[model samples]
Structure formats: structure tokens, C-alpha cells
Target: MNPALRLPAAAVRTAGAVSPRLGAAVAMPMFAHVAKPRPVSDDDAPTMSLARGRTIRIPGIDRRGVDVAVYEWGRGPRTVVLSHGWLGRASQFSALVRELVAEGCRVVAFDAPAHGGSGGRRTYLPDWLATYAELQQRYGGFDAMVGHSFGGLATLVATAGEVEAARAVTIAAPADVDELFRGFQRMLGHSDAVSAGLRERFAARYFPGDPDPFSWLSTVRRPLPAGAPLLVVHDEGDRVVPFGESGRIAAANPGAAVLPTTGLGHNRILAADVVLDAVVEFVTAEVARHPVSPTTEAAAPLTSRAEPVGVS
Candidate 1:
């Protein structure tokens, strides 16, 4: 009886009254609508007074004219990019931003297509990765990357040759795309025929030529690059993305450090001081461990001293 599950279930029931094919068609669009996060308003987000930042637009997936919104903060020697989860805005990192700046690390966060200040009515995982890759091209490699939930999956994907980062931290992230799809099917109570049909449409639309989109997009199937340090944090009470997802990532990568928390759930984990402290400590330690090379040391800084612009 979760509120989020109710709408999709109703839609499935309506569609099933017609035919399995019709049910699948109706369920697919409903799934997409629910999957693409709704935008978050400024009033609901934390105060953005401490950090200086600006927003930039980048082309979205398929070069479809949609623009992704990115916000950059701080001007420290080491840079860390943050990826917020589905339905989350860049400003959700307000607490972490303050801490990262205090520790002397520049921070960059973006609103994935159709979320926050980004342009679009619908979006998918490809759209998120596209926006992330664009930002990496604009700003160069990062010292570390931190992501939450869906963003966490994207961050893991980026480490696999898309972007160069010495370290990564993922909070409440799912490790397998197959598990995600299964969860979606359960939420909507779709029949096997309807689920298979939806999967076919999904594969055709997002991953043509790929025999199995589920395995192709799975973090567990395609593990993180060898020797790339990672920290996996998940809350025991996280009902959205199961904590076992984080466990899978940790088990798959022996080098990954797992930190389990209690009571914070999914969203609240982002604001918890203990989580922020762990992240700051890990990132700062990694930065210290890998000092900037003399050749790149002289390069101009990515941030400016001028007044920071507030991203809507």
C-alpha cells in the first residue's frame, strides 16, 4: 500500500482489463513517468548561502535539445563531483558542500535531465550519464566522485573509463539493473507477459543491439575498474534501494569499504552528520594521498572569487 506503488498498480489493473499487450503499453509509460523524477522547488531545499556556485546547460541524451543544469561550488585544489539521486536536486548536497568546502575541495553537482533546473519532461539513466559525461569534459577529471541512489549507479558507471577519479563514494545505491527492473515489476504487480513486453520495449528504445540491457547496465555485472578505491555507505532502514545492493558492490570489489548506518532511511542519509564526516574524511584523505602533479599544479583554478550565483 505504499503511495508510490498505488498509481502504477491501478494503471496495471486498468490495462490488464484489455489485453496483455495493452497492459504492457500502458504500464511502460506509467513506469517511465514514475521513474523520471519530479523537480524539487527551492523552498523545499536547504539554504544555499554558504557556497558560491553557478549553473550551466549541457546537451542531454540523444542531443534531443534538452539541457542539463550543473552547479559548481568552492575553489579548492582538489575537485569532487556529486551526483544526486532520482527526484533529487543539486542543492540536496548543501550540507555536504559546506563540509567539502571547509576541507578545501571544489565541488560540482548537477540536476539530471528532467530534474531540478534541467530541461525535459522525461528522462532515463542514459540521460543522467550523458549529463555527467558532459560535465566531466567541461571540468576535466575529478579527484573523487560521490553519488546517492541512482546517482551512485551513474558514478560507478563513470569510473569504468568514462571519467577519471581516484576514489568514489556511493550511498544507498543499487548494484544491479536487473534487481531494479524486478522491483519495478513487483511494485506495479505486472504479470510475466506484461513484464517481458515492457522489457522488450525498454531494450529496443534504450539499448538497441545489446542482447541483454539488464546485464549491460548492471554494476555487478560490470564491476568497478580494478584498483579504483570505493566507499559504499547504506542505511539499514533504506526502503527505496535495499542495503544488500551496497553489500553486493562491496563483495564484488574487495577494496571497497562498507559503512552501514541506522534510522536515516534513504533521503535523510544525505543530511546526516556522521555520513558527511565519513565522506569528507575519505575524500580529504584520498586527496592528501594523491597530491597534484607539478605539471598540473600550475594550471588555472576552475572556480572564481566573484560572487557565486544561486541555481534555481
Candidate 2:
């Protein structure tokens, strides 16, 4: 592939969104081909446990008596906020957080409303996006963000407006809104119209706007800011989300780099050595160039063994 066709580190750091229960339609063939069985629960899974961090209530912008959980750790000048995939909690990113904290970076993660320790019925894209905005107000600006699945999609939308993070990493995220919904519909044995209606109901009940319903891949219609970088990682063998979705984001964003791995599908990719290393290196290089603060120390260099293969 031409280097110009690749996504950049800054842009990759800020991509992706999460999805709901693994659709049977997408899971059967996909996971069977490349993904390991997911742990029964995220907290019980070894890859996602970070030493328990502090969780605080962040105000919700649109509702009354609502709050979001923010998990905070370390005291480094640079901060990384983690957003988990569907049904995942802030703690699912423990391994990544632990690694970054050890490198002198601060981290924050959230249990989207209805998941993990947060409140509400299961959430959709809008509320999560609002919660994202509200959380930014409380936590202040971050050096970068890492979002998986739905969270990745939310982060991309959130970044487009008031969110201030400069870098992001999106993992195994779906690209097109219609495709994602269709995938869910097929798994649930619902008609296209029925699925569309349910989606509208979910969005209206949980959020404020008519769902754009476009894929995140479609959302990236322009290149990332010349100064910002993005990294998109996916598994060609992923069963839950098509690898081509990630390709959409890479193709749309002028310099964003895409890394399609052989294994480590979906959830497991969160802790895959290459994934972690790629995230660390992307954030580290940007922090070095931008330098969150002159006094902030970076985490130790990630070893080559952990770096994503064939990624610049």
C-alpha cells in the first residue's frame, strides 16, 4: 500500500466506536475464524483489569439527576481517556492503563451509562456522546483518547466538536452506521424496517438528534488536522466487525494508518501486544512533538516485540 494511503498516528489515536451484543450473524463465522472466545465477563478477564482506579460522578448534560462514572489514575501531566466497547466497563482497559501509568501517563475511563458501574438503561450513541462531552468538561483536556467499538465511533463524533483530545486509537470498530444496524438486524432476525424502527426508538429515547445513521467510516469525510494523527487497528479475521469498515476510515483520512492483524479479533485486540505498543508509540510520539508539558515524563519506550507489524 502507498504510504499516503495510510492513517497517521495522531488520527488513529482518535478513531472507532463500540457496538452492542455480538450479533450472531457477524460472530459465528468471524470469531470462529480469528477471534478467541471472549471472557464471560470483562472484569474477570485478565487482559482488562487495571489496578482499581478512582471513579467519580460526571454530570450529564441533557438529563436530570444523572451522572457518568469516570475512572482516574496516575498523576502524570499527560492524560489518556479510555472508552470501552459494548457491555465493557472502564476497567476493561486495565492492562493498557497499567502500562501507560507505569510510563508516567495519567488515565481515565468511563462505564457508559447502563454498563459497568454507571446508571441508566442500556445506552445508544447519542447519550454516550453527550456523556463524552460532559466528561471532558470535568476531566479537562486530555493528551489523547483510546476507544473501542461503539466508543471509538462516539469518540470520532465527539472529537469533531468540543472534545479536545489530539490523538486516538480505534480498535475493531464498525465503519458504516447502516451496515452496523443491518448486522444487528440480521442477527436478531428482524426485518430492515423493523431494525430501523428499533434504532429510531433507541436513539429518540436515549439521545437528542435524528441518528445520522452513517458509518464512522463514512463520517471521516476529510483528513485529520495536519497536526493531528489517528491509528485504526482491526483484524482481517474479525467476526464481529468487517475489516473493511476500518479501511473506510483510513481511506477517508489522508494520512491515517490502518493495521489489519491476523488474530486478536475484537475484544482481545485490546491487549494484543502489537495493539498496545502501537497505541503507546502513537501517543508517545505525539506527546514528544506536542509535549503535554515540558515537565511531563513519558512512559518507557515500548519494546519492538509489542509494536504492530507493518505499521509506520
* Residue-level lDDT for 12 in candidate 1: 84
Off by over 4 Å in 1: 3-7, 14-19, 34-57, 287-312
- Could you tell me the TM-score of candidate 1? 0.84
Model 1, 1-312: lDDT tens per residue? 689668768888678667777787787766666244554446435445444544555444344457666776778888899998777878888888888988988888877767877777666666656665677677677889999988888787666535568788999998866666677777778787777777776676655655565653566776666667899999999988888898899987778988899999998899898999999998988432222333421132212111111110
TM-score per prediction, in order, is: 0.84, 0.69
Worst 10 residues of 2 by lDDT: 303-312
Q: List the residue pairs that clash in candidate 1.
A: none
Worst 10 residues of 1 by lDDT: 303-312
Question: Could you tell me the C-alpha RMSD of candidate 2 in Å?
Answer: 13.6
Model 2 misplaced stretches (Cα beyond 4 Å):
1-62, 196-218, 221-227, 287-312
Q: Once model 1 is optimally superposed onto the true structure by TM-score, how far is the C-alpha of residue 3 displaced, in angstroms?
A: 4.6
Which of the numbered candidates is closest to the native, going by highest lDDT? 1
